[model samples]
Structure formats: structure tokens, C-alpha cells
Target chain A: MSQFLDISGLNARIDADGQEKEILRGVDLVIPPGEVHAIMGPNGSGKSTLSYVLAGREDYEVTSGSVSFQGKDLLEMEPEERAAAGLFLAFQSPVELPGVNNANFLRTAVNAVRRARGQEELDAVNFLKTVRAAAKELGMSPDMLKRNVNVGFSGGEKKRNEVLQMTLLQPSFAILDETDSGLDVDALRIVAEGVKRLRSPQFSALVITHHQRLLEYIVPDRIHVMAKGRIIHSGGPELAQQIDREGYTKFLAEAA
Target chain B: MSAPLAVTLEPFRKQLEGVSGQPQKTALEALHHTGLPDRRVEDWKYTSLRFLAGSVFHKPGKNYDSAKARAALAALGLAEGAVAELPRLVFVNGHFVADLSVTKGLFACSFYTADKAEPGSLVRSDREPLAALNTVLAENGVVISVPEGIDAGQVLLVSLGQADSDAVSYHPRHSVHVAKGGKLSLLSVQAGEGHYLHNPVTEVFVAAEAELRHVTLQAESDAAANLSTLYAQIEERGNYDSFVVGIGAALSRHEVHACLAESFAQVHINGVQRLAQTQHGDITSVITHAAPDCISRQTVRNVLDDRARGVFQGKVLVEQIAQKTDGYQMNQALLLSGQAEIDAKPQLEIYADDVKCSHGATVGALDDDQLFYMRSRGVPEGEARQILIDAFLEEVLELIGDETAREVCKTVIARRFPVSEEGA
Candidate 1:
């Protein structure tokens, strides 16, 4: 059987003021269906760059890499095509689309994905039913859905909106890009609960974070330490505990 | 300094004499000697009519046939036999076709005929020069008057454009009077498939404690040129709302000017202009506060795609006596293509001590992050861009209080942004 998401020798660079800076160097990772993997890294370790490359952002140039999702070439597809193929990336900093109502935008996105998969669009009644339930589960108020997407929303609300999109789209594989950064303890628990509700054999997630606080709630099956543009260590969930106890001081010295 | 005014006064004087009614003709002639508005004219700087220096246009003759007028109306989806309950006033090349107009209790005949009937009435005799120019040159105009304390139901004024074998120029005049304690709603639609020129002037007077709502939609042929001006005066305790939506012509200029002449009056103006290809559309507005405790809000949105160009110039002025005045203006444009251009200016001039006034103008392309966000949701790039564009313009469309009118405006904007075609 094919892996849910596979990345082999993924290399990336940043061009700054006429000089090339290597960010991700030959990073290899494999996420099988139904498993949650956590990637813990220090700053400048290319955690965000990996998410950008996976989501097909224009600025990031993948120097050398192969990314396959569910037996399809993920790197070749457009960002939207990747979304339709059940690949989702919960952005670290959710974008604010002023004047676009949150409920209307989510419905459009859901219908677009449905249409791509040869499915009929959801009517207003059915869409409201699905979204209202998810919003309730995520502790989001009904008024939040009526407002412009993420505009003037608190950091916690934006993270909740990301989770709301994840719940609405039901992607097979999701990349949580430091979604717990600005959230308080309560918000982090709510988001973790939202992810837990969506967990199933057909679903998988790659959680990229700097701290082990989020991993405590989501309970990843495995943890990997990344430094100096590559994954340096891999182990079970205890690795996260060790990192939480000792911090990245030892890892930084080794990386240097 | 006065030499240019004298030079400009010659043709206006000649045109004033051609105005029929004695009192109106005399007033126009006197104003003509005062001189034509030039660059010195605060409002005429951007739009100089010096282009009409040597051109002579004949006053339209009443040689229009009822059958031809009906045909023109039918072509505009306003068929004669249709069961729609709209008060339709048909204008053939700026002349009113009485056979096609439906006038009831409050709504009267065209402006010329109304003025002829009610010559000494306070409303008819009070005419400006541009209005007088429209009067002498207009083949026909419409008047919708709501009596004191009476609510005038929705009124739809349809300006039909009918071109004879010879190219023609038309100036259609419209005057709306809302009496004290009255309410009025008017939808003015200008539709024509001819290659003629249409210059329309509409004046609205809202009395104390009255409410008036005016919605204007213009969809002239691509080969036609349209110039529309709307002037409104609001009295004490009155409310005025105006919206203008235009799917651009070869050259389209729409001007809306409103004066809060009395205390406790309010004005709201919202407009949208959509242009494609070589089309040029301009929307200019001025709101003045002459009395204390008045409020004004203006929002204008323009969408220019392909090689189209759009212009929006808005101003809000509050005099010293107009204390406690609150004014806000926002003008935003979406340039879909690199070649498309937009010139937007929002100005606020307040001489009052205790007044709140602000203005903002922005011209930009679609947000790249928002575009990526939409694209990442499985919407194609073209569709994503179109969605953002629609959302951008919807800010203005939402100001229209009527649902049907807002839907019509949205449909017209959608057609201008075709997802299947590039640079459209």
C-alpha cells in the first residue's frame, strides 16, 4: 500500500540579497495513514519552509525533492489541486480576508472541493447544518461565522477557524504548521480536541511545532528532532518528553 | 481673468435665448452672461467641456414615432405588453414619448410639460443653468413628485435611446420632488442600443421630514457616450440615499452632488463602476454641509479589467456654520490586469470647529495571500481572482437597500469579469 504522504530528499533554499541560503537539506519523512508524527525543531530549522513547499506557495523554490500524496505527485499539482486531493495545511498565521464572510468562504471552499471530486454541491440548509455542528464542537460562536474571515479576530479565534476549515474539508492528510503558537491553554485544548475528533484510520497528520505543549494534547505516536536543515533524531513519544525536559541546548551544540 | 468667462458666455447666451419659458429663459440668459464654467469652476476642472467648443448640436425635434419608441423599449427587456407594474417613462433620443409614459396621481408628465403646466410653482421656476441647458436642448424629460404627507410607491423611470439614421445627441432632464413627511423610491434605468450621445440631468428636492431613495443603473451600448449629473438638496429632518451602478460605455461620466441645506439632514451615496477593454468610466461626487447637525457617507468602488480605465473623485465639504457635521468617504478600486488603471481621489475639507470628517482611497490588485488561500481551497486561479474581485465590489453593492437592484448590479459586474477569458 502507498504511504499517505511521502517526502524524500526534500531540499529548499532562500535567496536573500543575491546570496543563496540553504534551508531544508535532504529532509526525508514518511507519514503512513492513521499515524500522527511530530517534528520538533529550533528556529531556522525550515519547519515553516517545509509547510510552504508542501502547500505550493510561489516564493519557496524546492531545490531537489519528491513529494507524493496518496500515490500522486503532490509537488506537481497546484495548491488548490492539492487541497482537492485531501491534503490540508493549517497555516501558522491564518490569513485575514476582509469583506469575505467566514461562513460563505468555508461553504465555497467545501463546494469547490466537492465539485472537483465529481460531487454535487451542498445546499444552504445542509451546509449550515454541517458547519454549525463543527463550530459548536470547536467552541466557535455563530456570530463568528457571520463575520469576515479572520478579520479583527483574536489569535485564538484564527486558530479555531483553521480547525473549522479542517473539520469542514475533512482532508486525508493535514499539516499543522505551529498552530499552537499563540493559543492559550484552553484554546490549545479545544484545537487538540477538534483534531482528536477527526482522527481515523484513513486520516493522518504531521504536526510541526517548536514546543512539546501541543504534542501533549494531540499525543503524537512518534517524535523527530530537526536541526541544521535536516532531521537528526527520531524516536517514540518519549523523545518529546526528553526534549521538554532538556530543551534544544544539546541539539544546538551538536548542530553547530 | 474674466476674459475666459466672457468667451465662455457667448454660446450659453445664445442657447439661453432658445429656452422657451420666459422666466426660466431670462434666468438662464442672466447666468450665461455670468460665463460658462471653466477650469476656474471648482467642479469643472477634471471634466472640461471645451471639447464642445466648435460643435453645434441641433435641438431635437418631436418627430419620434410611438412604434419606434415601443420597439426601443422592447429591446431593453421593457416590453410594452409585459405585466410588470413599473411606472415606465420612455425617452426617444432624449425626448419623452407620452404614449409610452405612465403617469398617475403624484407622478406627473415630463419636466418640460410639467413646467408648462405649473409655470409659477416654486419647484418648476427654480432651475440651474445646466438644468436650463438640458431644458432647452432636451427633447423630453420626466418628473416624479410625491405630495406632502403622502408616500410615493416605487417609481421606475426608463430612458429609452432611439437613434435615427442621422447620429443624434440627447439631453434628458428629470426632477423629483418629495414633500414634507413623504417617502419616495425611484429606480432610473438608462438603456439603449444606439450610437447616440445621452446627457442627462436629474435634480431632487427633499423637503423637511421627508425620505428619498434613488437608484440609477446605466447600461448604454459600447459605442455610445453617456454623461449623467444628479443634484439634490436636503431640508431639515430629511433623509436622502442615492446609488449609481454603471457597466461602462465608450465614455461614461456620472456626477452626484448633494447639499445638506438644513439642520438634521442626512445623505448617503454609494456607486460602482465596471469597465473592460478601452472603456472609460468616471464617478465624481460632492457633498456639502451648509447647516449644523448634518451627516454624510459616501462609498465608491470601481473594477477595471483589461485595458479599461476608471476614475473616482469624491469630496465632502463642511462650512463653519455646519457644526456637528459628520462625513466619511471611502473609494476603492480593483485593477484586475496590469494594463488596467484607476485614478481615485477622496477629499475632505472642513472649516467647522466641531465636525468629524475622514476620507480614504485605495487602488490595488487582488491580495496575493487571499488568492493563494482561495486557490488552496480547490478553486481555479481564474475563479479565485474573480471571487476576490466580486467581494471587493460587493462593499458598494451591499449599500443598495433593494435586493433586486443589488442582484442586477452583481450580475452586470460578473459579466465584466469572465473567468474563461483572459484580459477581459
Candidate 2:
């Protein structure tokens, strides 16, 4: 396989005041199948920008680069198409859809993906049963399923809801962008557990975080250090500990 | 009393001139005094019935093939009418269709055939010229009366318009009265085909301690015009609750004039209108708190697509003597197309010092963030848009206390939306 996810010479810019400002400068990275990779970076290091680009957010312009998922061009697909193609992005802050029933929203997403993947659609009763079970495993209340999607949900609840969606979608590759932020320790552990449960030879993940706090619960196979819109270092899990102990001072000095 | 008549309105004036009864003459005189309200008139500023001046609507004599009428009736999903278990009183083109009708609670043949005109017990005609015109022309209608201290289960009235090549108009005058401590729930469904104008003026009376739940739906053919008006009067401790749904017609307006005539009476005017394409809809209400401690509430929602336009003009009048009055009204519109338009006017005329009255109107397009969120979740843009629109309408539906009636309201709203599904 030509690199499960191949990103080469990725150059991106964001629009600010009718002007394009470079964010990602000639960055290159790759994640093979079944490997969990963590990208640890400080603020303004373009960690979030990379996740947003991979998720196909329209605000950012990709000046130059090629992204391949399973040998298929990923840049040409819409956000929903990317989702249907097994690319899921766990948002740091889940959107609140007032008046949209949580169960209804979840069912619509599930059925849509199933139809795209040619899987048999689940009926309402079966859907409820499955969702109830999954929700219980995540320590969620039945009322959460009855309320509107993410409306008035607490910070922890929103994070857990994101995890619930990831578990339900079961994407081949997931980009968890700071899902550990705004989450309590217990919630962080539970969310990490949810991601760990999906670990398999067929699944891989790109976890982006500013702190190494999340890597503690879900150990990563590889750790990458990013600074000033570029990955400056790559090593084993020990790199996470090193960064936690010394901070990005040494890395920034070296990159400069 | 006729206002200056245009060339088109002369015929109505002549027709009114021929009728001599005081009520009919008074109505005709008023029509003559006001002629047909044009742009100059305050109430008729947004909607112009000026076409009715030039247009001639033939009497309901052109009977069509029963099959088309049956199809129109079937498509209405009358089973969702809530009171489906109750026998339905069917009216076709302002004339009762006995073959397809069975009525319970209270029914009178005179109201259907115009064979007689009994003195109307509850007449609170507003100053609108259309109200006066309806008085002179109204012949087909229904009259229901509940005895004192009795609870009548429910009653349904269905009016179907059979398509005809020639344009026509008819006024169905419905009069209902609930005596002291009486209860009544009335469901009215108005649907039709072809180029026609359905003007229905329903007058309801609720005695002290009585309650009336009135739900009216106007889903006429896209080619037709519907101008429906409701007049309600409430006494001490009486409640007049109503919900009106406007979904069809090229030009339509659901107008209401409710007066709380006694202390402690309450009135609720909640409704929803969905219009698409070149259609135009208006929901106008004028509620008056004439007694102390009376309350009134109004909530209306509109979903517009294409070049469709919706108008809301609601006014709450708290009389100087009516202290402790509580009145509230809110109107919201969702524009689904760039060309769609909504005009909202909330007028609050409160004279009481110790009263609580509030009114608000909002107009906006589909939220961009909400749309992106749903689409990001894998819902196609069209379906996601439909979901948000549906959700936006639920807040108004929740105001409906009757479960079955709420379902009926939602069903009508849904059937009217996704307009492409119907045209395609």
C-alpha cells in the first residue's frame, strides 16, 4: 500500500482581511494503516490548521499539496464525501443544532453512511437498541439521546457526544483534534477509551493535541513534533514524555 | 356607506343594492362606503383583494366529475384531521355534498342550501370591507350549538373545491355557540382545485365557563385564492383557543378578530403558513381585551421559498378599562430562497396601566452554521435544509395542546414543504 495516508509538500493559507496568510509551509507526513500517530505542538504551530485542511474546511486555501487516502485523491471530495469515504473528524467543539432531536440526527447520519457504504440500513427499534447500548457503555444518560443534539450540553457532555459519534461512524481513519480539551479527567479517559476500543489492523488515527495529557490514556505508536507550520521531529512515544518535561523551548530553538 | 367603487367593484355594489335586509343592506352599505379596500387602506395595505372587484365568481352550480373531487379529498389525508373518528360534514364548492357527508354534534341543511337565514346570535363583524361583502354574499355555511353544561366530544367540517374552467367565489358562514360550562372542539379543513376564491367567515361564541377549541386549515389549490376570516367573542371565564394553518393558494390570508368581552376570558391565536414558488400568504389578527383580567396570545410562523412572500400584521388592543390584561404575540419567518420576502408588523395599542403586553417579529434566512453542521454530519444539503426548516416550525407547533391536532398541523406543514416533491 502506497502509504495509507500520504501528505506531501502540503502548503496551506488562511484568509485574513482579504489577504492570504501562510499557515502550513511545505509539510509532509504519512500514517500507515493500523498505526496511531500523535502530533504534539504548541499554540499557533498549525496543528489545528492541518486537521481543518484534511477535513476540507472551505475557509483555508490549499496552495500546493497532494493528499491521498488509500491511493485515492482526498482533496477533491466534499466534507460529507470524505466522511462517506471513511475520514472522520472529531471536532473540538461539537455544533449545537437546536430543535434537532439527538436520536433523529444520529439516525440520519448513520443511515446516510450505511447507504453510501452499501450496508443494510437499521430500523428505528434496532437503531435505538444499538444506540442505547453504546450510550450506556459511554456512561451517558438516556435523556441525552432524547434532547436536541448538543444544545445546552456541558463541555464534558459535548466531548462525550463527539466520542459517541466517532464510535457510531466507525471510520477507517479518524482525526481527533484536541478532543481532550475542555474535558474533565474522567471524561478524557472515557473518550480515550472510546478511541482505544476502535484500534485494529483496519483502523488508524491522527491525534492532534497541544499537551501530552491525552497521550497518557491512549498510547501512541509514533509522536511528531510540529512548530512554525512544519513537523520538526518524529520519534517513539518517549518523545511525548520528553516534550512534557522540557516543553517546546528546545524544539523551537532548534527549528529557528 | 360605500367607498368610491372601482369599475370592477360596481357589480358587487349593484348586487348588494338589490338586497334590502338591514343586515345585508348594512353590509352592502358598508361595502358601498368602503368599496374594496385598496393600497390606501391600513389593513389592506399588504394584500389587495382588488382582483375580486373585477373578477366574477360564478355560483356553485358547475358540478364536475366525482373522481377529481374524491382525489382532492383523498390527498388531503382527512384521516390526519384528528377528529377523523367523527363523521365529516362535506361541502363541495360552497354546496353540501350529501352523498359524501355525515355530520354529528349539530348540523343544519339551511346553512348549506341558503334556504333560510335565521337571526345570527353571534355577529362581531370587523370594519374590513371583505367582512361586509361576506355578509351580503354568504349563503353556504354550518351552525353548531352545544347545550349548557354539556361536553360535545368533537366535530369535523371539510370543504372541497372541484376544479372548473371558469373562476368562482363562495362565502361559507359558520356560526358556533358553546353555552355556559359547555365544551366543543371543531376541526375545519378547506381544500380545493382550479381558479376559485373561498371566502369563509366563521363566527364563534363562548359563554362564561365554556371552552372552544377551533382548528382551521386552508390548503386550497395553487391556482385558487383563499380569504378566510374568523370572529370570536368570549365571556367571563370562557376560553376561545384557535389554530389556523395556511399552506396553499396563489393569494391567501387567514384573518382573525377576537374580543374578550368579559373578565377573565382568554384567547389564543396561533398559526403557521408555508408558501413556495410565486405564492403569497398573510396571517393578520386584531385581538381586543375589553374586560379586566382577560388574556390574549398570538404566535405565527412562516416558511417561504422561491419568490414567495409572507406578511404578518398583528395588533393587540387593551381597552382603557381592561386592567390586569395579559397579551402576547410573536411572529417569525424563515426565508429559504434569496428572492423570498417577509414583511412583519406588530402593533400593540395598550391603554391599561396595569397590564402585561408584548409583541415581537423576526425575519431571517436559513442559518449558515446550522446548515454546515448538518451537512458535515453526512446529511445531503437538501435533506439537511428540510430538517432545519421542520425544526424551526416545531416551536410554534408545541403551543398546540391537543396531540392529534398538533400532528395534523405538522402533517399539513410537511406536505406543503419540499415543494419540489409536489411539482416534480
In model 1, residue pairs whose N, Cα or C atoms come closer than 3 Å (at least 3 residues apart or on different chains), thus clashing, are B95-B140
The number of the candidate with the highest TM-score is 2
Clash list (residue pairs), candidate 2: B1-B33, B2-B32, B2-B33, B3-B32, B3-B33, B3-B34
Chain B global fold similarity (TM-score) for predicted model 2 against the true chain B: 0.92
- Could you give the interface RMSD of candidate 1 in angstroms? 1.0
Error of 2 at B362 (Å): 2.4
DockQ of every predicted complex: 0.60, 0.65
lDDT of model 2 at residue B231?
82
Winning candidate number (DockQ): 2
Q: Model 1, B9: alpha-carbon shift in Å?
A: 14
What tens-digit string does per-residue lDDT give for candidate 2 at B177-223? Answer: 89999998877888887888888888889999999998888888898
Tens digit per residue, CA lDDT, model 1, B169-283: 6777677889998898777777675566678877788999999988888877776778787788999999998898888467777877789999999999888888888888888
For model 1, residues A1-256, the per-residue Cα lDDT tens digits are: 2777889999988787878889889999988899999999888888888888898887777889899899999889989889999988999989888778899989989998999888899999999999999999999999999999999999999999999999999888889999999999999999999999889999999999988899989999888888878888788998888998898888777766
TM-score of 1: 0.86
